[model samples]
Target chain A: MNTAILSGRELNYQYNRSQRQPEGGKAALANLSFDLFPGQFLALLGPNGAGKSTLFALLTQLLRLQQGDILVDGTSIRQARSAALKSMGVVFQQSTLDPDLTVIQNLNYYAALHGMSSREARARSLVELERLQLGDAAGKKIRHLNGGHQRRVEIARALLHRPRLLLLDEATAGLDLETRANINRHVRDLCQQQGIAVLWATHLIDEVEAADQVMILHRGNKLAQNRCEELLLEHHCDRLIDLFGRLTGTQTGELTT
Target chain B: MNLATASYCFLGIFKRELHRFLQQRARFASALVRPLLWLLVFAAGFRAALGIAIIPPYETYITYEVYITPGLVGIILLFNSMQSSLSMVYDREMGSMKVLLTSPMPRSYLLLCKILSTSLVSLLQVYTFLLIAALFDIVMPASGYFWLLPAVLLASLMLCSLGLLLSILIKQLENFAGVMNFVVFPMFFLSSALYPLWRMRESSEFIYLVCLYNPFTHAVELIRFALYASLNLPALGVTAAVTAVLLFAAISAYQPRNRPQRGKPPS
Candidate 1:
């Protein structure tokens, strides 16, 4: 039940603000480490600029790992990047779909990128689209879809490969509360039913549940990591907002209730 | 990479590019018009101003239209290659490049496949321009058209590789217009594209020397020779060498290890 699907050890990342001084100034992620187990929904809670997307970039092989080891299903990303990436899927914070193409076309292109046959790609894309309730819109151009629908298409595209690990970098961003809740529920159901491990990066505290495993990242540091209830108990706060405030030294009512 | 997977990657990218090219009517029109303007208006205006000595590729005196057709072919390819680079920058901005780069295939193979697909699209544009030129009675040897296919393909690959290198060096899409002006203009003007090397020499020795060294000049000369049913060994050698070097440089620039902070969040 606790088998690790993804693990990173002492991961480090830096961002040079100025090109004139490329030497070094501040690190974006400082010696970060964590593990995600099969069928686990790890809510990677962090404020903006907390290096959530940076970490996702490294895990997805969009950026080469600089200073540590990242293993996806026991395959090292540094040494066996293609093999490691093959077992993972990612939905970036930004919409990556081509607006000019139909939803099915975008999904089929992604499936082909993973070397799936045309027939397999079409069948899988339809199944995923139907699952996302986007079956009727598959033939429509992405530009015709709303923000929530576009995000759904992106998610369906990501799952077409049936990867063991799904990484969502603020996947519910820019959606209304109801739509955000729906996406969250759907992804959580995927974790439970498909046994796929998920690492959901978000700044919203409300999206987390008391039973969910949570990792609070602030300013590139892991401030807290445990079950949500445990963290609430540890910080002696019933709400995650208060716990986040106490951990990060930020007093705000942004994530209440 | 496995053969099946490689074919799939190649075909998928090719189809996507083709689809996008077809959908953007303005882009297609501009790609064709740029060369047509050079072939019809510019060449027609310059016809009386320039004189043609019997060159190796040309057994006898040829009209300016025939002489500049290959060069105009080069232009179509040059613009298309740069357009491909533009799309690369746009894809990076849209975050779609992240999806592409994260695919299970080796990055180098995928990058090469992208260049090849762009070359294929550019090849189609060249042939379209040639067919239009043929309608205007600027015909090459019957067999020259077939022979020129390989030469056009090689030149397209070389130019596309140069564009890839430029895209890697360029950091943003908003700044690419400046680069296009800086690169595309200098390469087109200082090459054998608009005028022959002898013509350039008659104007200025230094300018002629620059044209002689420009890789685009060799690519033009290569296409010219092939279009006349003869092979220019020196031009072929030089263009091949430049393609190899530029391709290596572009691949090196594309290596993730070289740019640690490449996948920055969208602004």
Candidate 2:
């Protein structure tokens, strides 16, 4: 396989608060590193406060790097943020779409942010919305659309720039099961067909298929990383749910009651 | 920063803000109403109570309404600045701010674009107010109307920069109200908005000098001079310098994509 499309080395980040005692600052991410291969779908599994969102923020350049470095297609994020961002698409955990704007307008505005002309943006937006099965809702305001449709619009907006890598931070959190499955299938197909790398952050282990790579993060540290099947077998757990419990040291049987 | 890219970023943000204004029609109406109420009701009530003094910009005794037009303009700019900052906080909470800040453009250029967009909206509101003022026979000289544009632009820059800085420093929307009560009121009141600096000088030279140093005072003075078809170099210089400083401070405080530190989480 070609070199990883995105990689981070010794990424360390600590929250600095002047009002806190000298030692009170929290280390959100500590000496963590990973590489995402081209065309591979990698799911990051972690519990709440496991630094999943923090890592996403750092990767997307929302937060400055306090230590270490990130590379996008071999260019350092610090040295070439614009070029790096150009190659990456991000769907944040929260909704970034304007509620007042129609689905098409939201996508067009995002395209403009990337410096694309209106004509080109409209053409691409139509194609992307069609591909996402949201063409019918193109003219509806985001506030009028259901959560699932709104999420699809966000996905369509992210792809308008045609980035080589896609970063999704809980992109399907509030969607219904059927809608979530459809989104996952579409994302999987996109990765396979376009040779795009994907890093999907989620707490649910079922979201990670047997064929895909899985990175287990616990308390800001990467505990294990491998194909889902290999990880399950190595832990002597036949099911992903059981394996997830073993890996994260959570009480597995308690939920059955 | 590349000037072309900066211009593009500026235009993009400007368009977004304009769209926001169109979407929030109620907000625009409310913004207009507050100033109109002051111009009509409050100015009418105070016109007889307040005595007038001949200032440099005014050759003859002017009505209280005419004297306070520049101050009311400053009020529009002030409120718009606070609204812009409030929206910035809302954007951050909603995550759209990340999309704008992460663009390849320099942080300062992005902020300047935000300021420009906000100021454009503020200027639109001010012109509308001026039109109404004209209907009421409070209009300045025709030449003064032309100078209003640049004066308004400078005042918008200064206030918007201050708002941008506040947005960066304030972690929560709740605290912004306190800032409004403390910062906005003092700046508006202590400045020569309601009275001339010379009037304040008779009471206390220190208050006069403080007013002289206030960027808002300079903003009002600049507009006052423009209202007479003249210029105020000191006011223009002070406003520009303060704008540059605040803009620089705001840009320097921006931290790419990194999440700002929220206060201590519950134990």
Candidate 3:
């Protein structure tokens, strides 16, 4: 398989704090670079306002690239955005589902947006729902589902396109610890089983496992990128919590797991 | 985008809009009720007071209800277009618009599909109003029913484009209600929808001139002429020109380079 499914070089973005002062803006993302090979689970660790979502926005072409470029399987996101986006799927931090729409309808609509035929979309939707143990809930409206279930349905919808690269932004936000851990496991297993590269962005440190590749983003800059275990050892910390606290300038008070 | 993909995207968006329209019973009710009230109650009250002379389409003086039926249809189209724009604003706030923008299709195609879908729904609302108008004994030539479809479609596109342009100008969903009132009410009253330009000229030449300049006047005239089984060349020409210009502007507003940043952090 082609190893590097996604890569970015010198990605940069800045937002004007005040419209009147054009020069008075802070860099949201600065000179960041990263790569993800096929079947790898890469964790993007950042606190709030650390520019994790900004990077996702750049990758998804929701925000125009101010500088540099991103490539999906060697296809340039800037030069050929459509072709680059065709192989990727995204789960935003906020709920994007139509609350009035049934789960099946939502999945089919997304599949159609990805250019899948109705029959193929239905089949893939069923398979994805089954994978998420949501087959029976397919007929239910999204408003009726719990927060965790809704997120699962969103994941199913995202995967219906069979994207090789999955970009998830705070996918487990607002869920209980057990539900969050279960979702983390499910996505991790999806990475290994489907051989799809996953970039999971979150502020939670416990979600990162020892084997996953970790990229610590702080204030629009990449502080470190390495295997989670090696990073912990290099930082001289027993737990990722302490390491993350040190990097983000916050002290860990309580550990969940 | 390829033909197959384009067709799929169009169908998907169109179906979603249709389903949403169907599910919102209150929207459907209000959309129909507003125009019907104008035809039945407002026209009834004004029938004795206003006098419409021998219009070109009519050899004899016509009832006031018949005179304003075409205008009410215009009202339906105008309100529906603005309502759909409100949906676009709501979609942006709810994060669904992001999902739509991320599609692999060209941005122009996606936005066009969105505008066209809303136009299609507005067309349905137009026809429903017309059907109710006919049931009230305010009938037109049978051929007008068929020809009015294309006229309504064109008018809907023009009005939908105008709504989209306003949506782009007005940033927030919360502000949409105020904008809708300012735009929809003025456009409807300033045009020939409620009163003829000639009648307005009798009262105030300036308002008559304003009505002449209003694009909604041409839209209503286009449907009026089509309903009479005749073509109004100037109305058709102006409506088509306005549609092209506004559609271009709307598309430009939605382009990624022109898309405005919502909050401090990107999502």
Candidate 4:
């Protein structure tokens, strides 16, 4: 098995809304490149329109690669789709779980999508639910759960396949501070214990801990990528918010704490 | 596409659709109710006003209830197609469609799976309608039941493909009602659903030709012929050709990696 779980080289994408564009030529992502190794927790930080979602779409094969290539576990996403998807799991910025389905049902359905048998799916679902502390909410409909619990269920569902690489796009957008911290700790623990390569994408600087690898994106370009401590040292800044504001050119508002 | 993978994908989507329908029992029942009202009450009143005509599939004179059974079947398939497409739009809005589209499977196969799943659900609803029709003594020839399966399946595929094609072209759910008004009623009324093509000819050969060309007409004719264990070669050919065209068009519109692009912020 390849140690490098996810790698993208010179990825480029453009959207041609013929009516809006000047002759319909607008680039969404340009020459973006990055690599994620096993057991590494990488945080992708960018402004709202900095192409982070576009990058996520490209990595997950949700958007076509107009230029460049991506390989998941040594298999090109375009050429070896089934094999690549089998080795990777993705959680989009928006919720994907069916509100009508129970927590257990949602996980089982996702397992079935990967061709698992009903019995195997149920067993895996139980294990994932237990891991996320959602075992008690297994029979409850997803609509009944609070936003934080729903987000946890989504994470647990993604882990059902035991994918070597887990991609989370804005996984904690609306969670309260305590809930976000709990989920973050759980995810970090999972990466350490299971050695799953994680690519966590978010715009919030607070989400990046003192120790994870950080990649800052601006205008579809990778401006900076290094250890959290190193980035702060390079920028002569102690707080992540200050560094982020400097990198992305955004004004900082009142601090949460 | 890989047939084995396609089969698995089809089964997975089909099962999910079935679960959804079962969970939303009111919607399923209401879907059946619309056609039932047309078959029992509407057909009952029209039976007296409408004159009898000698159709090939009918050995002798038949009531309007028996005559419109196939059309009622078409109605179920048509409504189900629109319903499935509506769900697709909803899925796109809710982000579940992204999950299915992002799967390693080919886009065409994924779409075919969606069509097949919706077709199966439509067929089930048709059977439920047929059972009720039987209770009301609006049954066809006893042997017609077996042949009805293939006819229903074909019609379901054709309608579902058309629905899939529509979903790809229409980007938003708001545009759906306009599609329903402009497409659904015209296809249903302009075809031989409520009246024979010959009857349409008496009204106007131009209208009759339009009916002959319409795929919905062939779908209805195919079911009508099968209701008597007879085959309509022309209807079969037309239905098959239309299905192929629509499926091709649908698959072309859906690219696995075609994500919504972000635009510049408003000035």
Point out where model 4 deviates above 4 Å: A1-3, A17-24, A253-257, B1-9, B257-267
Model 2 over residues A103-206: C-alpha lDDT tens digits? 88777777767777677788999999999988899899989999989888888888988999999888888777788889889999999999889999887655
Q: Write the per-residue lDDT of candidate 2 for residues B76-165, one digit (tens) a residue.
A: 999999999999998877767767865656656677778989999998899988998889888899999898899999899889999988
For all predictions, the C-alpha RMSD in Å is: 1.9, 2.7, 1.9, 2.8
Give per-residue lDDT, candidate 2, residue B85.
95
Tens digits of lDDT, candidate 3, A134-212: 9999999989999999999999988988998899999998899989988899998889998889999988888988988
Candidate 1's chain A scores what TM-score? Answer: 0.95
Query: Tens-digit lDDT track for model 3 on B47-132?
Result: 99988998766668899998898898898889888888888888777888887888888888888888889889987888778887
Provide the DockQ value for model 3.
Answer: 0.62
For the record, the alpha-carbon RMSD of candidate 4 to the native fold, in angstroms, is: 2.8
Candidate 2: which pairs clash? A61-B257, A62-B256, A62-B257, A62-B258, A63-B257, A63-B258, A64-B258
True contacts reproduced, candidate 4: 0.37
Evaluate candidate 4 and give its CAPRI docking class based on DockQ. acceptable
Two-way TM-score contest, 1 vs 4, winner: 1
Q: Looking at model 2 chain A, which ten-residue stretch has the lowest summed lDDT?
A: A248-257
| Clash count list over all predictions | 0, 7, 0, 2
Looking only at chain B, model 2 earns a TM-score of 0.92
lDDT against the true structure, per candidate, is 0.87, 0.83, 0.87, 0.82
